[model samples]
Target: AVFLTAFMPDCDGPRTRVIEEVPVSDWMDSVVDEEHAPPSVFLGPEFVRRKLYQLTSEEDYTLCQSLARVSSYYVADQQQRPPFSAARYGAVTKVYVIAKQDLAMVEEYQRQMIAGIPVAEVREMADADHMAMLSAPEELAGHLADIANNYT
Candidate 1:
């Protein structure tokens, strides 16, 4: 599996193990639902573009303006998920593709994740942002194809 600027969990740790705290300001005009064990926030356009789709085109950015969904952060149902054991899911060949321009997760944090999860290989797309498939779709696809051809 290729992780493209995503939430990468260590095989032996929680999903939030390497995640940095997102500041309240970063959430912008979030409409929050406190019904869950922890409140879920719906990201506004400003936050989404700034953090996730910074390098994407106007059309791509516009698509999110209407269809953005609530964030699963701090949700109650998923908090109980256990880590991936070394003998199970972790045994798969993992290839992490780092989006260097990603503002949401950032490259340093991405490297930190690879450090924890023993990946078969690590690739980097220097121009891509967090939403790499949108920002750099062709490059991302090429990388994925390469990984599948060689690694899988």
Candidate 2:
């Protein structure tokens, strides 16, 4: 699947706030230092709602791990990388499905990304969070199915 839910790289919007704040200790726990080895960043349970999966159900939130580690170097690299060029995927249909209730990236930033990139189509998940697959599974799945049917 395409990168449907995550914040886009080139949107000069409020999502930049999240990127600017990510390397800080309060938001990320650097478990593996790149100075010694490959760098890794972990997000605690408390950070899930505010940063990753806002509006997630209590049960799923609890099921979520307090520490989920990912490569800090990779994340840092992504922040510096340029946005994907639409010309590279000549005939591919690019659809952006926005999660309106996502607090991590915010709705305004989502719209800004779409406007900046010029997607083939835009769809909204009114009540969905960043983790829409868990927060609003059926609706997300329906959208996915529709995309597959129409785009593919």
> Which candidate number has the best lDDT?
1
Candidate lDDT (C-alpha), each: 0.78, 0.66
Question: On residues 1-152, what C-alpha lDDT tens digit does candidate 1 reach at each position?
Answer: 77877777767666555543445565676666767756677877777888888889988889878788877666344446776677877788888999999887878878877887788989999999988889888999999899989975
Model 1 residue 46 CA deviation (Å) reads 1.0
Q: In angstroms, what RMSD does candidate 2 have relative to the true structure?
A: 4.4
| Residue-level lDDT tens digits of model 2 in 111-141 | 7666666467888899888898988899999
Which parts of model 2 are misplaced by more than 4 Å? 10-36, 70-72, 76-86, 89-91
In terms of TM-score, how similar is model 1 to the real structure? 0.85
